[model samples]
Target: MVKKWLCAVLVSWWCLCLWAAGAEHAGEKPLNWHENAFFGLHFDLHPNAGDTELGRETTAEHIREMLEKVKPDFVQYDCKGHPGYTGYPTKVGAPSPGIINDALKIWREVTREMGIPLSIHYSGVWDSRVLEEHPEWARMDPHGNRHPNYVSLLSPYPTERMIPQLLEVVREYDIDGMWIDGDCWAALPDWSPACQAEFTRRTGIAEIPKKAGDPHWEEWLAFHRTLFKEYVARYVAAVKAEKPSCLVTSNWSFTVRMPEAMDVPLDYISGDYDPSFGAERAMVEGRFIASRRVPWDLMTWSFLKTGDQPWTFKNAAHLSQEVSTVMAQGGAVFIYDTPQRSGRLNSWHMDVLAEVARFCRERQPWCHRTETVPQIAVLHSESTWYTRNDPLFNFGGANQPMEGALFALLESGWSVDLLNETALAERAGQYPVIVIPEVTRLPEAFRQAMAEYVEGGGRLLISGGEAAEMFGELAGITFA
Candidate 1:
């Protein structure tokens, strides 16, 4: 009787799969690439540096030399703020005098010649000029103090002003991609007039929470995420409209809760840094590599104390794990060096990267694909992750407090990606089991989808925060 029941269940599942696939419309977008990839070495443009300045042709040439030497599959060009910007020979925004001669073309020509795709990095969070030029665009903290290096998503400038300049640069230069840094949309302050107005409009409540977990919080929090998602959609659209093949993603480290919304418009997604620093960081990084629908890139050296300043972590295990994780994910690994800040590339760092490069080359077939038979799908939602923004409810870490827990799983042999809820809705059936480590504030749409999947037989594990309440609310069921 049990065998008969099992067979019947299998048949039902097979039928559902067929139906879902057939349900797609002719104009519906196709599935995206799930592969391991590369992000280029990141060296910030310094005005006064050793034979290199921001926007200088020499810098691009030097970068090209490094790429030729490293033979990386992709590379990123840093566009420093103010006079140091490296985007292109732009008329909208003034690029550094360093490239006023012909450096921009050299950098562009070198990457194209090398056949390695180029990604440009920009600090979108804090622009001194933006603040100075447009005080209205600045986000004000509770104390009424404006923080440096932070941009208010509530400001319309990104879509109106910033994107056009970015497009002009891309179109003029024919660049292949973008990496947006300092995207603290989730952490944008509460005093923005735009946010206040939106909050009032959405929940009929004018008061914003002073902290993360205040009573009327989830609604406001949801708005913040919604705004960010829309911003991402717009940014991605601008790039793809100009160059459909161009890849683009913002830094999403701890901001995403459910699976990423792949349908939202992104060629790929990435994070600021990876924190796996021990022997086990490698496998966990590998798991992160495979967890995303698109290729993942690991940030290296950004978080470290530079050797030039002061070195931390004797072994360089952190750097090694960066490459390992990206390789494991069948994604790309990016190494960032901020002049004298991210320390000089020591022999140890170079050696680890070299080994990783060689390993990726050797395992090209397996390392270039997203994981199949994923043992776990970590439920990620921007709404839930913001719950940690509470000073009191402090879950853990700046990026993914659940990393330690996820690491435990990886150490015990598990792979995972911190995906947004939208991503979860579409791909829920792919995984047999999913673990929502402390997710709260579930989106109704994602909840309904998850409920159906689980009822049809999906195993779920959740911990910390309001995962229980959310599950109960969403599915009309609860799990401990």
Candidate 2:
């Protein structure tokens, strides 16, 4: 009887030690700003031909008025947009036409005084100036002609001109950070002499494929992926070297377009949710970003503009609904707004933001840093998306399958997490079930991890024909 009692006491003591250690570890984890409910504003201002001195002054006044009405944690103002035009006087890039004063400087001064963090919206990898000045820096097409739209990261423009200009904003203006736009949207496979030589050097293939399905097409795709990854990493490193506290993120860096970009040392992850499909996209992307365990936010358009139509402010009720959906999935909220050419913000927009801010602020207690109780996890393979048509592996194109799975699970009222392979390998055991939806190919390491997860009594639900054919035996079934 004494021996059994002593053993019980030892077991209880051991469990208590583990529990104490876990509590200490949890306490040591630092809190991120994104872990809380953050309300921010994104303003994209591109002056047109008619913008005059009166417009600039009025706009500046309205900016102060708007801030007073709707206080935000952060505001992202335009520095340089897609047209490679700066709203401020810039030595490194072209200034927008008809800009009489430095709008960025005014915004910096105002936001700083207001005690709000300021970020700039700068377009990267797609500068129209390079198209005109150095067309060779543009991405090359199969016809050996430069694309009129995008600049290649392989060019010296990003390192020499772009990074320098970005650092200039941080140093000269004392800005908080940069929300880099047009990175994923502008990245394209290049067939330039440099790319061709590098491909040959890496793969030992002298001839490069001209189009999809040609010889070595897969190798070409893989090469571009690696190129962009390295390109982003280098730029991020450069920015940190200059200003370690300067938050830098390429738009859509960690979303469906370039999940591998998470490997880059970015301060945070964010994407502008499509206005048309804002709710659905936010639900999926929020889970994806949250799984990375980094700070993330989703930007939604304040107005719903369709196909060259004039912009109109979204109703407060609609905006509130959209914000709630994102916050519920553990994402902060940023609303995108385009100011009038006169530089004045609409009072209606301010009222709308005020209402939405109130909604978010009220829910801070329950919503901020609240852990998501995940019931299901859907595996999203970045490799499958990147190498979709290689003929070497079976995988579907784009994120349609993953989206379909999310929709179905949500419709059935199940809480789901959209996990990348890395997240799944690490935390697959936490959830009750793992779902592989339409992912035809998975890396060997991920495959082994999934097998072990299932063998250890975890449940799995796999859909899609190709996935069934591959993982059928592991799930205790055969296709015959």
Candidate 3:
């Protein structure tokens, strides 16, 4: 039977996010991320150290032209990226070489004048600059070698650099907020002396595990994960305390990729799905965020992964398909684009953006803030994924069985919501059918809950060897 339910439509078309470089709104009241900020444009270059002539050609006319044509809800411009270089010159942060013009000023002026919320894409945890300069702050790998890209949480990088730069941009540009990238996904397990010392104090585990198979391996991973969570909470709190109105979100913090409950003080939740399987990735990410209690959106890469192309811009129809996938899943959508080295958008790029804008606006009235009517609850087990995978968040890692299961149900045309142990515990009987897909292990509490739910006549569907063995008797399935 194809699981189905009524789709409750809440129609409030959001503004276009025409972010040529920086940018929001149609209604009399200004739209923000909390409510009406729907369609968006994300333009980034991931600022590098060797970059020169940054924003030299990003004139007022070019930004205004693109904004007028697309008229997005909010515009997110590149501020700081993985390289730890700032696009705009700042008194506090490491500025890129040869930044001639005040591009951030121009973007803020135009966006503010046009009454649109202009946010920034700032790289948080991963900083090559920080790693090179402060070798002591680097996250040490199990082999005693400091990471070449990531920073250690036990170090003062967050306090000394990350938070200061955030506050600096907030106060300097008077910008809307920041979409923090390279954060949760960029976190590496810190095995540095400082981290190990602190981990020992907290957990009383004197012997630190050097590898995943060593003694107290789970404890070591859990300890690092806890520290990363603290790092996020601290920075978010600091930013909000400094600018209470500014929105803050780390890309993919509490999404399906993390398989954890929403605990951070994130103003919104988001993640940029890898373009390799762009459509399929959105199918999982979009639905998971839509099920979240906070405001959320998914960013789509504007181009496909062509080996030679730096960023090969996809045609309007191709991008529109990705946008439609996100819109149909009941969350706002943003299309990611890379501008020229001079920070100017070429006409070729504009042509595709304008066409994509038309497509997104056309569907705005119907799919804006669409809510999922949950019919099938696909359990995304935190224990299962964490035990199998190494990182805290696995966006581009192995395709957990949950992905295949969700994809199968979706292809079969069932309305599904991906839920984890925390979510299911609160509402075990909510979904009409609960499907446990091939998990190596499940919490005993969940097993008891599922058994009780089945005893009370709720449908339970178990698949895969491990999952089937766990609930084989409950499912009344016998294997020879």
Candidate 4:
């Protein structure tokens, strides 16, 4: 009996060891060129109605010229845009009425000749054609009316149409990857019958909230957030299942817009920074993406607008500055440009991009794979951003004290990283100082993690009355 018990225990121990080894291997992935300083171009090709004749030969010549001049490692040309029009001839979906030639095919062939990887900018959730063809796929509002703008992922269109179309492009084109646009950031609370039924089935909450202030509003928003996240995961899995080597990512997947989305299996993370906000936002976004241990690049628009009008091309000096901020935080850079409706390249824009590329090339060695020694970490509560819609506390609050705190820290020349609750809990001890930044509502686990961090001799710089009230003792302050 004793010998048999010992044999059983040894077998169990050996099985546990094998399970651990397998778990570790599951998390490992091979690094690619995207991990280095990749200078890329994102060409937007949404032409106006009158500009239908997209001179294929001229466009190819322009692409060749641009490639020769700019020398980008990768180029993301438009396959589909927010308007839900395909740049290439398609049997599945609506091709742009204005496009006379298959521009995507042309670009793919040219980029292949140039020995550069080509990625497609395909709109995911915010597709207009899906909404127009199947109104049932549109996100329904409180009034039972469909939103004309974006498609609901909870509907059947994503599985039936979106994923299949993505696979179609991958199988047909000689493309490297896909940068899926308008995913999590464009998600809305869907009250469609399918969504409601699924929500009720999952949560057992029979009553659905109609408005923001209604009971269970927070729960409803949380459900929708998870729904969009799951949708992205499904799309990524579907694409990879078809083409395992095909890299895939949704815009703003790991950025401030949807930090939790970093958990999704993406080849990389990227987003176009608002040129109006300048380099400050880039710096903030870069640090956030870096924390996720993934390759990331932030794109800057070529033209900066004054109000509703496009004023002028952002010069090389301005662009170089933006690139500097991204690189400083250990990220690559991509400059965004819009091609003319007639499929002509702007020589002057090519010159500007060349100059920017030269700047990145010179600094690539120091910037690539460099580690950021974070001195401070600011908590960016994704939960707070999702559930709470108060103008003073939510997205409209200008990010409130969080932005203010980050700005002050940047001005003071302090290296900062924005961490969500999960990251904060896991990495709280790594930072010498952690800032709460006026957050009122926080999970108990995160609060306890901070407390333990402080007890372990980590410094805490917390702002706001609510935070002060909760952690006053740790900061050696008495609250009334």
In terms of TM-score, which candidate is strongest?
A: 3
| Cα lDDT of model 2 by residue, 1-480, tens digit | 434533554464345435534654565422222333288999887533344541365445667778767767778988877777777777886766667667788888777655566889988877886577788888888789998768876788877778888888888897767899878766778988888988899899998999887998878888887787788788777876665556778888877666553678777888998786688778878888878778788898988877888866788888888878878876788899887654567788888898898898888667754568978999888777766633212224467888788888889999988888887889988999999988767888988898899889899888888887777779778766
Reference-based TM-score of each model: 0.71, 0.88, 0.90, 0.89
How many pairs collide in each candidate, listed in order? 25, 1, 9, 0
Q: What are the RMSDs of all candidates, in order?
A: 11.1, 10.7, 7.0, 10.7
For model 3, the local distance difference test gives: 0.80
Higher-TM-score candidate among 1 and 2?
2
After the best TM-score superposition of candidate 2, give how far the Cα of residue 327 lies from its true spot, in angstroms. Answer: 0.3
Superior candidate under lDDT, 3 versus 4: 3
Per-residue lDDT tens digits for candidate 1, residues 277-308, read: 42244444445434454556556553445446
In the range 403-469, model 3's lDDT, one tens digit per residue, is 8889899899999888888778677777779888888888899898999989988898888998998
For model 2, the run of ten residues with the poorest summed lDDT: 28-37
Per-residue C-alpha lDDT of model 4 across residues 1-480, encoded as one tens digit per residue = 434533553464345435534644575342343654378999877532344666444467778877778778778988878878777776787777777777788888887666566889988888887678788889888789998868877788788888888888988895778999877667788889988999899999999998877888777877887787788889889886665556788888767766453667888889888867669778778877887778888899888887888668988999999889888877888998887765667889999999999999998888865767879999887766654443111255636567788889989999888888898899998999999887777888888999999889999988888778878777788855
Candidate with more favorable, higher TM-score: 1 or 4: 4
Q: Pick the candidate with the highest lDDT.
A: 3
**Candidate 2 wrong stretches, greater than 4 Å:** 1-37, 47-55, 58-61, 307-310, 389-397
- Model 3 lDDT-worst window of ten: 1-10
**Sorted on lDDT, highest at the top, how do the candidates line up?**
3, 4, 2, 1
Clashing residue pairs found in predicted model 4 = none
Mark the regions of model 4 whose C-alpha exceeds 4 Å error after superposition.
1-31, 47-51, 55-59, 389-394
